[model samples]
Structures are given as structure tokens and as C-alpha cells.
Target: MEPFQWKQAAKGPSLFYLSSWMEGEALTAGFTGRDGGFSKAPWQSLNMGLHVNDDSKTVVRNRIAVTEALGWPFESWTCAEQVHGARVHIVSASERGRGRDVREDAILDADALITNEPGTLLASLYADCVPLYFYDPVHRAVGLAHAGWKGTVAQIARHTVEAMTAQYGSHPSELLAAIGPSIEDCCYEVDGPVISKVEPLLKELREGGASMAPNALIADANGRARINLKEINRQIMIKAGILPTCIELSQMCTGCRTDLFFSHRMEQGKTGRMASWIGMGRGEPFS
Candidate 1:
């Protein structure tokens, strides 16, 4: 069965939840869909990102709706100003609610956010870029990372794991991870420029005992290849010592499911973004 279960709230935003993880623990982990918000036209309804040319007030409203639907307060939402870099920010209690309403206050120049602080939700915006989630049940820490091809090549996945380990003393082997919805290989084709950069990273992962699916990065005679970024990141996690059995992969493709997800590639770069979030209160071991 697919890990992310789709649910439409009666008066709330459409969501794809990592329900098994939420049910077994105090954590709430999921990705937002492209419906049930108040944004108009290209971003019509359920747009959770403020940087996508959506009105600030409407974006805040949509964010509030998501918080309410999760039974969490809006003040608990913390965001990152992603620059496609590998910088992983460690969020604490003092950092709660940054960028909940505006972009200026966001944790700047970071693509990954990790926190062991309870009640502080970690969120990042995504259109076609992959969302990488991390949870260290050993240290009660949760993390979220945004990975476009740039961030992926920068090794954002491995950096997130290292950050959690360094800050929370989290052992990568004990981490539970999830690769959220994004553009899969079927709809993600890249030319030589991108391929040149990604090849080195894939080569390193391969040398480190990390394997990739055949469709993960397929090349054509024309110098372009269909890349499964999600799988590539998964291999990165493995290279970083995260157990393969502990990782969950979402099968929903943003490009094919544009009706449910906002796909930047499919929409010609004129689309809103979905948000991936994960947080939990202080708690005991995973149930």
C-alpha cells in the first residue's frame, strides 16, 4: 500500500498524510495538496507557500487552515527560506513561528530544518522539488529538507542526517525517514548540464555501497536523461548510514498528479507550492 493516504477535510485543505507514522507516535508528518485554500487562478485554493506570488494574507489564511486541520496552533509553524543550498538550520524554542506570516522573518538561506523542540512545526515549500523528512525516535528530533536538483547535488539529505546526529546525538541507523511527493523520473528529464553535476554524487554513493534503481537516472542518446530524484536521495540517505528498511517512499508523482499537486515543470514554472511539515510534542519512545 502507498504510505501517504489522501484525505479531504470537510472545511479544511486537502492533504496527503503519512498516517502510519502519525498513528504510532506523537508526530504529525504529511504533505499538503493543491486544493481547499483561498488563492486564485494558477494558485487557486490551498497554496501554502508565500513566495509564489500569492497574496500574503491569503497564504497566511491557507497556512492557518492547515495548522487547524492538524490540531496544531499557527504559532507552531516555522519555515525556511530555501536557496537550494545544503545548509541545515537547527531550530529551537526561540525560533518558533518564524515566517509563519511573512518571508522576511524566515530562517534564511537554509534548505533543511531540524528540531527536537516540542510544539514547533518544521515546514518548507515545494512545487516539484522533493521534501525529505527525518525523525530520530532516540532523541525525539524531527527534521525537514527541500531538495531540488541543486539541493540534491549539494547532498541535503546526508547533511540533514549529520545535523540531527551532531545536535541531538542522533544515530543515523535509528532514524526513520520519508521521501515526500515530488516529480518522479517519468516526468523529470534533464539535459547534460544537470547530468554532469549529478553524476559525481551518484558515483560517490555507488562507491559507498548505495544502489540506484534503473529508472533513477536514465540517459538517452540525445544527452538528456529521466532522473528519479527521490530514489537518488534515498541512496544518499543510505550512504549516510540510514537503514534502508526504515525509509518510506511516497509514490505520488507531482507532474502526473497536477490536479492534486502543484507541478512547476508541468505548469511551466507558473504554479504555487505545496508544504511538507512534521512536528511532535515531547514524548516517549515510538509506540
Candidate 2:
């Protein structure tokens, strides 16, 4: 079964809940779909990013809807100013609500956010980029990362795992990770310039004993390689010491499934963004 289960409502925002890791009341982790809110076209409904040209108030409304669905307080929402870099930020209680409604308040220049702080809902925006999730049940830590090709090559996944290890004493082998929806090899073909950057990374993964899929990077007559970013990222996690059995990979290709995701590649450059969120809650609410 797909760990990220589609929990669609008749007339509300469509969400992909990370069900496998939600067995306890202490954590909430999942990705959002492109529906059920109130933004106009281009960003038409459920746009969680405030940086896009969408109306800031409307984007805030979309975000509030997701928090309502997750039953988390809007005051706990936290975010990072993603720059496709490998920088990581640890969110404490003081940083809980930063960037929940505005762009300038986001954690500066961080592509990954991890927190052992309870009630801080960590969020990162996505369109076709992969959403990497991490959870440490023993230390009660959780993380969210946005891995575009640049971030993937920069090893944002490894950085997130290491951040949790250093900040909360969480071990990579014991951490649970999940790679959410993104463009797959079927729809993501890169020319030589992009392939050149990725080739050396793949070389390192092979040298490190990563079990890459045979089709992880397929070559064609045009001298371009169709890259399997999800698998590549998975192997990167393996290289970072995360156990293979503890990782979950989603098969929903954003480029192929436009009905469910906003594909930046398939849609050219105009589209809304989705939110990938994770947080460790304090306890059961009195409400």
C-alpha cells in the first residue's frame, strides 16, 4: 500500500497523508495536493506558498485550511526560505510560527528544517521537487526537506539526517524517512549540462554501495539521461546511513499525475505550490 494515502473530501483540499508514520499521536507528516482552497487560476486553489505571485492573504487562507485539516494550531506553523541549497535549520519553540503567513519571516537560506520542539509544525513548499521526511521516535524529532535537483545533488537528505543526529542525538539507522511525490524518470529528461552535474553524484553513490535501480539513469540517442530522482535520493539516504527498510518511496509522479499534483516541468513555469509538513506534537489537546 502507498504509505502516503490520498484522503480526499467531496468539497475540500485534497491531501496525501503520510499514514505509515502516523501510528502515534506525537507526530504529523504529509504532503498536500493542489485542490480544496481558494486561490485563483495559475495558483487555482490550495496554493500553500506565499512567495509566488498569488495574493498573500489568499495563500494564507489555503495554509489555514491545511492546518485545520491536520488539527494543528495555526500558531505553530513554521517554514524555511528554501533556496535549493543544502543548508539545514533546527526549529525551536521560539521559531515555531515564523513564515506561517509571510515570506520575509522564514528561516533564512535553509532548504531543510528539523525540530525536537513539540508543537512546531515545520513546512516546506513544493511543485515537482521531491519532499523528504524524517522521524525519530526515540528522540521525538521530525524533519521536512525540499529537494529540487540542485538540493538533491547537494545532499539535502543527508544534511537533514545529520542535523537530527547532531541536534537531538537521533541515529540515522533508527530514523524513519519517506520521499514524497515528484517528477519521475518517465517525465524528467535532462540535457548534458544537468546530467554533467548529476553524473559525479551517481558515481559516488555507486562507489558507496548504493543499490541503484537499473533504470535510475537511462540514456537515449540525444545524449541526455532520464534521471530517477526519487531512487537517486533514496540511495543518497542509504549512503547517509539510513536503513533501507525504514524508508518509504512514493510512486505518484507529479509530472505524470497533474490531476493530483502541480507539475512545474509539465506545466512550464506557471503553477501553484504544495506544502510538505511534519511536526512532533506535545500531547493530546484538551479541545
Candidate 3:
């Protein structure tokens, strides 16, 4: 069964909830779609990114709409600048809602955001790049990571897990992880540079006795390869000590399903962004 289940509302942001996580206590986690907001062409209707040339006010409205739809307060919306690095910023109550509306106020130069602070919604924008989610029910900590090809090469998955372990005493064995919508290998082809960086990671996984998908990296005759980023991240999580059974991988591909998602590659770089959000709240019901 698909882990991120889409829920359409009559008048709100269309979203895919990480359904299994919703069954837990006061935790809201999911990805937004390209619908039910107020942005114009190129950004279309529901662009959630402020830095992508979308009107900042319109982007804020869309974001506020998502928060309302999730039954989360707009005041709790928080984010990072997402520099595609491995740095994980531990979000505190003081930093709550930092990047909710403006880029300058967001967590700087960090691709991963983790928090044990309830009511702080950690959001990271995405078009095709993978969204990595971490939840440690034992410690009541949650995290969101933006894993572009660069961040993946830097092992952001491992970094987030290690940060949660250090900051919140979270055991990776108790961490439930999820890989959200992104371009799949079917729609994501890469050149020598990307392949060079990814191959060593594959080698490391193989040497570490990890069972990776055989087609995780498929090569072509032109020194190019199709990479399954989600699977690669899944293997990275396993290498970082998260159990395979505890991880949920979304099957939706942004490139393949542009009708339901925004694809920077497919759209030739003129596109909006969706958001991946995760946070725990105080006695809040799952909306």
C-alpha cells in the first residue's frame, strides 16, 4: 500500500498524509500537493516556496492554507533555507516560525531540521528533491530533511539520524523514517559527476552487507546513469541503523506525476515547490 495517502478537501490545500504516523499521538506529518492555493502561472495554484520567484505574500497564504488544513497554527510553521548540505539544525522553541513567511528569517544554510519542541512545524520545500522524515516516538522528536542530489551525496540521512541521537537521545532503532515524493530513477537520469559521487556510496553499502535494490544505479552507454534516490536514501537510513521495516517509502514520482506534483526538471526549471512537514503538537487532534 502507498504510505503517503492523498486527501482532497473541498476548500483547502490538497495533501498526502503520512497516514501511519497520523495514527500516533498529536503528530502531524505529510507532503503538500500542487493544488488549492492562490499563485499564478508557472507557480500555478499552490506554490509553497518563497524564494522561487513566487510572490512572497501568495506563498505565505498558500502555506497558511496548508497549516489550517492540517489543523496546525500558521504561527507554528517553520523552515530552513535548504542549502543542500548535511548540516542538521536543532530547532528550539525560540526558533519556531522563523522562516514561515520570509527567506531571511529561516534557518540558514541547513538542509535538515529536527525538533523535540512540540507545536513547531518543521517544513522544507521541494520540487524533485527527496524529502526525508524522521520520528522518534520514544523521545518525541521529529525531523525533516531536504535531500537533493548534493545533500544525498553528503549523506544527509545519516546526519539527521546522528543529530537526533545526539540532541534528543533518540535511538535509531526507535526512529520511524520516511522517504517522500521525488523524481524516481525512471525520470531522473544523471551524468558522470553525479554517478561518480554516488558509486562509492553504493560500494560502501555493499561492503557493509546492506541489501540494496539491484537497479538502484542503472548505467547507460553515454556515461550516464539513472539513480533511484529514494532507495539510495533508504539504504543510507538502514546504514545509519534505522530498520527497513520501520521506513515508509512513497511511490509517487514528481517527474512522472506532474499533474499531482511540481517537477523542476520536467518543467524545465520554471516551477513552484511543494512542502514536506512534520511536527508534534500538544493534545492536538489529527485533522
Candidate 4:
């Protein structure tokens, strides 16, 4: 079964809820689609990123719409200036709502955001880059990481788990993880330099007892290869101590689903961005 299930409302942001997490936890965790908001052309309809040249006011409005749809306070929306690094920022009450509207207010130079503070919605913008989510029900902590090829090479997934463990005393065994929609191997092809970085990670996984699938890296004659980023991240999580059975991987490919998602690669760099959000709330679940 697909973990991130899409839910459309008559008049709100069309979002995918991490259904399993919402079923029994006071958590709102999921990704947004490219619909039900206010933005023009390239970013048409529901662009959630303020850094994408969309009108700042319009982007803020779309963000507000998402918060309204999720029943989270717009003031609780916190984000970071994703630099594609493995740096994880620990968000607290003071950092809540830092980057809700303006890019300048966003947390700086961090690709992952982790927090045990309830009611703080940690969001990161994405077009093709992977959205990695982590939830530690035991510590009531949540984390969101932006893993593009660069971040993946830096082992952002493992870094996120380690950060959660260090900051919140979260045991990786108790952390539930999810890899969200992104460009898959079918659509993500890379050159020598990128493949070079990924090779060592594959070696590490194999040495760590995690078997690599044949399709993990499909090489062509031109020194280029298609990489399965989600699987790579999954293996990294397992190598970092998360059980394979506890992780959820989304099969939705942004590159192949332009009708429902915004793909920077598919759109030739001209596109909007979707958001991945996960936050623990006070009492009842919003979704």
C-alpha cells in the first residue's frame, strides 16, 4: 500500500497525508501537491516556496492556506534555508514560525530540521529532491530533511537519525521514517562526478550487510547512471539502525507525475515547489 495517501478537499490545499502516522498519533505529516493555492505561471496555483521567484505575498498566502488546511497555526510554520548540506538544526519554541513567509527569516544553512516541540510545523520545499521524514513516537520528536543528490552524498538521512538521537534521546530503533515523492531513477540520470560519490555509499552499504539491488545504480556506456535515491536512503536508514519494516517509502515520482506534482527537472528548471511537513500537535490529530 502507498504510504503517502492523497486527499483532496472541495476548497483547500490538496495534500498527501502520511495515513499510518495520523491513524493513531497526534501528528500531521505529509507532502503537498501542486494545487489549491494562489500563484502565477511557472508557479501556477500552489507553489509553496518563497525562494522560487514567485510573488512573496502569494507564496505566503499559499503557505497560509496549507496551514489552514492542516488546521495548524500559520505562525507555527517553520522552515530552513536548505543548502543541500547535512546540517541539522534543532528547532525549539523560539525558532517556531521563523521562515513561514519570508526567505530571510528562515533557518540558515540547514537541510534538516528536528524538533520535539509540539505545534511547530517543520517544512522544507522540494521539486525533485527527496523529502525525508522521521518520527520518534517515544520521544515525541519529529524531523524533516531535504535530500537532493548533494545531501544524499553527505548522508543526510543518517545525519538526521543521529541528530535526533543526540538532541532528543531518540533511539533509531523507535524512529519511524518515510521517504517522500521525488524524481526516481526512471527520471534521475547523473554523470561521472555524481556517480562517483554514490559508489562509495553503495560499497558502504554492501559492507554493512545491506544488499544492493541491481537497479540501485544502472550505468550506461556514457559514464552516466540512473540512481534510485529512495532506495539508497532506505539502505542508509537501515545501516543507521532503523528497521527496514519500520520505514515507509513513497513510490510517487515527481518527474513522472507532472499533473499532480511540480518537477524541476521535468520542467527544465522552470517550476514551483511542493512542501513536506511533519509536526506533533497537542491533542487530536488534524488529518
Candidate 5:
């Protein structure tokens, strides 16, 4: 399928929008570009990271607009103070609005969140980490995962699938997945240490009609190997039982699309966060 369209939101400064195509229920999933909120430059408008050192008040206001646009209550959204780990929190009705509360221990160090509860928004913050959205139309359940290179090699996407199967009785054949906007291979370069972790999973691509000879490694200008993260994680999902036709990856890269996204690498550790969030609709899809 073609990539989702990006549009400007007239309600604020320069907000952009994203939508997914799993061809089922009224579920919404997308990432916020660096716009439409109350934060200052570098943050620009909608900077959603609570720990990004942006003014807390601005972050709160931006989040409110996000939920409002999704037709969800501002208080019902859920998120984590992600620390680039593989922890996944299974959200429930009892834990509704937990991320919006003042508890310091609100699902500590989690990098992923999944829930079947309609109207509950599950998401994680990122500038370059891949955001993976999961939906089982047959089961009417949805999940979200944050995959950095570390998480991808750890098979977090596979773990998410297994979690859905065990927790919500979701079947792999019935699931639809979308890997949201993040750093693409064009802008993501790595060293031997990182390549060692990704090599096993990348064997498929090495054989898939690329310019390289089989069993040969390709390095960059600086002589460091680069890996295609989207391809690697796609393998993880397929290995975990998702059909090849059920997956989508963003064509846009945050590190490359500087005007539209916040790239932590491009910004040199001083940038705002873009959020990838998913929520079940209010019985029916909303415009």
C-alpha cells in the first residue's frame, strides 16, 4: 500500500497527521510531527516527550490536543517513561489513565504497551526508534511496540505477537501490523557490534536481489556496516507468524525528513519527541 498522507492542521501552528490501513475496526495510529503544540523552537509546536526538558505545561497541552483530535479523553491516554528496554506493559481497564496520573512508578522502564480496551490510547515516545502497531481484526484487539536496534534484535516484535496470542487469544493469521515512521536505513549507520546482533536476521535480505554477493558484508564511507532496520523487523514479525501481506513500513525517515520529524541523531541530543499512538474508536470510526 502507498504511505499515509501528511497534512497540515489549521487549529495550531504547523501540525501534521498520520493514519494506518489494516482494513478493520475504528482504530487510530500515527506519530506527531514537530508541530501544533505550545512548545518553543527545537520543540517547535507539539513536543510530546515528558522528559525532553521541554516545559511540562507545554507537553500537557500538546497531549490534550492529540487525544482530542483522536476523539479520546485527555485523561484516558496511556504512555510510559521509556528507557530503551524490552519491557512491555499489558494495559487493562483497571490501569486506565495510569500514564496520565502522578504516580512515579507508573509502569517503569517499559518500551511497549498493548491493550484491547477501546478508547484507551497506548503509545511510546521516540525520535528514531521504530513504532510497531498491531491489530487482530478477527480478535478485535490491538497492540503497540517500540523497537530500537536493541529491541529488534531482542525480538520484541515477536514477543508482542506472542503476548497478544497468550493474553488476548489473538491469532497470528488474523493480525495486521504497521511499522510507523522512524529512522530508515538511508540515515541509520552502525558499527560491527551493532551489525553482529542484526546479521543473522539480515541473511534474507543479503540474498534478496541486492547488489552484494551472497555472504559478503557491505560497509559505508567510514568503513562501518549499515543495516536496514525495517527489513530486519519485518522478518521478526513474519517469523512470529504474521503474514507477509499484513505488514506496512513507513517510507519517511525522521533523520532524513528533518522538516517533518524530530531526529535525535540529527538534532544531536537536543530535540523534541514524536509520539506513535494507537486507540480503539468510539464504537465506530470518527472523521
Candidate 6:
């Protein structure tokens, strides 16, 4: 629940794991910090959001850099035009090049995506909202979700797991979840209305306790509350039947680290997006 950071290693990006989920297969995942991209100024480096006033070409180049840094081919990575809804897409080999050509528009109105095919990289962009990655090696399945407060309150992460189970027969006990970087409670203050909508679910996870009441979670400073997105998502994963030890969360707040990540809330909409992804590999290690 406390803020944490992944030290920048000399070899590559900040790679980490959810102990329960990191077992078995080889997979690499993490957020792209403000370093290692081709953008300048507000966009800075490693900016992955294309609609944030950054050059389209530059975003493509930046994305290639990110994919390559992970030892994955740029051509294999698949992205979507996020619309902040709960719609989930099941990516297939035929849909691999849906949005790469710039000449063709990518699938729209989806906030989450999953794939069971190897070498199929599925990703969802992020700014301040939390990015979650799911993997079920037992089922050879994986999922990615972008949870802004709306999506979080809607329990999109839980939805993804359920979708995986229904579609791919994934058992939560065998699933691994990773919560990527996002706005933390220290910097993610919110109003009472938002807290009111999500309190019931929070309460249910806390064993139906009263500590998660709307007023209890709100702060007096802004006459609102500062909800811990990381904690909220973690609790959702548990309630969805995911083992706590199977979840890995990045405790960094995007808003607080404007110099390292794009925070839409902190930057007031003048920021780029970060990419959080998950994929299943068929023949090679994800590494």
C-alpha cells in the first residue's frame, strides 16, 4: 500500500513480477517511464499517447523503441484506440495488423483486450489511470485492462478475469495479475460521489466492514477523498478469486512523478499516454 519504485537497472527497462503469477513461462511487462522515447518538451521521451498532440510518426517510433527494448518484435505488438468503456476484445492472429498501417483505423470503444496466441502482444494505453496485466500460464491466456476511476469502480479488472474464465476456462487460482504504474492516493484525490459509487464493492472485499464508507475514505483537505487506486484494484483482484500473492502492483503515482510519466490529471490533459501490456507466447520466451 505504500509508494514504491523500481530502480532503473543498467541493462534494460524496469522489469518486475507478481510472485504467484511470474511462475512457469517467460513474460516481460512494466510501464514506460519518461525516459527512452523520441518526443520532446511536454511529450518528452517514451510518450506512447498518439492523440496528445504528439506527432504520429514520433509515437510510432517511440512504440517501436519500447517493444524492441523488451526483446519483442515491433510488428507483433497490437494496440487499440481506447475509449474508456468496459468493452473487452479477444485478439486473434488475423487481427494482428488491425491498427498498424496508419492508413487503417484500429478497433475502437475497447478498454481491455486478451489473447491466447503466442507472440501476440496486447496493450492498452495509460496516462493517470491504472493499467493492469493478467496472465494464466495454466490456460495459456492473458488480458490487459485500463482502469480509470470509472473503470475501477466498474471492476473492469474483475470483468477481465471473468471474461478469461468464460472464454478460455482460466481459473483465478492459476492466474497472475500485475498492476502497472498509475496515480496513487498521495496524488489521486477524488470527490465523495466517486467514492460513494465504489464503497460497496470495497466494503464487500474488506469482509463487509464499515471502514470503507464514503466519508471514511474521503479527505478533509479538498472536501473530498484520496482513494488508493492500487489498493482498490488489488482488493478487486482478490475478490475476483485471484490470490493476493499472485498480484504485483507498481506503487508509483504518475501525477507525482510528472518528470518520469505522463499524468493527465497533473498536466491538465496536456500529456501523453504510457503503454501497459500482456501477451501469450507460443514458441519463444517473452523475454
TM-score of each: 0.97, 0.97, 0.98, 0.98, 0.88, 0.86
Better of 4 and 6 by TM-score: 4
> How many clashes in each structure?
1, 1, 0, 0, 3, 2
Show where candidate 1 strays beyond 4 Å: 282-287
- Report residue 94 deviation for candidate 1 (angstroms): 0.7
User: What value does the lDDT take at residue 141 in candidate 6?
Assistant: 84
lDDT of 1 at 205: 80
In model 4, state the lDDT of residue 7: 89
Candidate number with the higher lDDT (4 or 6): 4
What ranges in model 5 sit over 4 Å off? Answer: 13-24, 101-105, 203-217, 221-223, 283-287
RMSD of candidate 4 to true structure, Å = 1.0
Candidate 3 C-alpha lDDT tens digits along 197-236:
9999899988998889977999999999999999999999
Query: Judged by lDDT against the true structure, how good is candidate 6?
Result: 0.73
Clashing pairs in 4: none
Candidate 5 lDDT, 110-201, residue by residue in tens? 77788888778886788888888888777778888888899987778888899899988999988999887888767888887888777765
Give the alpha carbon lDDT tens digit for every residue of 220-265 in model 1: 9999999999999999998889999999999999999998999999
lDDT of 2 at 92: 80
Question: Whose lDDT is higher: candidate 3's or candidate 6's?
Answer: 3
Please give the range of 10 consecutive residues that has the lowest summed lDDT in model 3: 278-287
Local distance difference test, candidate 1: 0.91
**Cα miss at 132, model 5 (Å)?**
0.4
Per-residue alpha-carbon lDDT of candidate 6 for residues 116-160, written as tens digits (9 for 90 to 100): 877877777888888888888788888899998888888889899
TM-score of 2: 0.97
Q: Kindly report which residue pairs in candidate 5 clash with one another.
A: 35-46, 37-45, 37-46
Please list the residue runs of candidate 3 whose C-alpha ends up more than 4 Å from where it truly belongs after superposition. Answer: 282-287
Candidate 1 to truth, TM? 0.97
Give a tens-digit lDDT track for model 2, residues 92-142: 888889999889998999999988888899999999899999999888989
The Cα RMSD in angstroms, rounded to one decimal, for candidate 5 relative to the true structure is 3.3
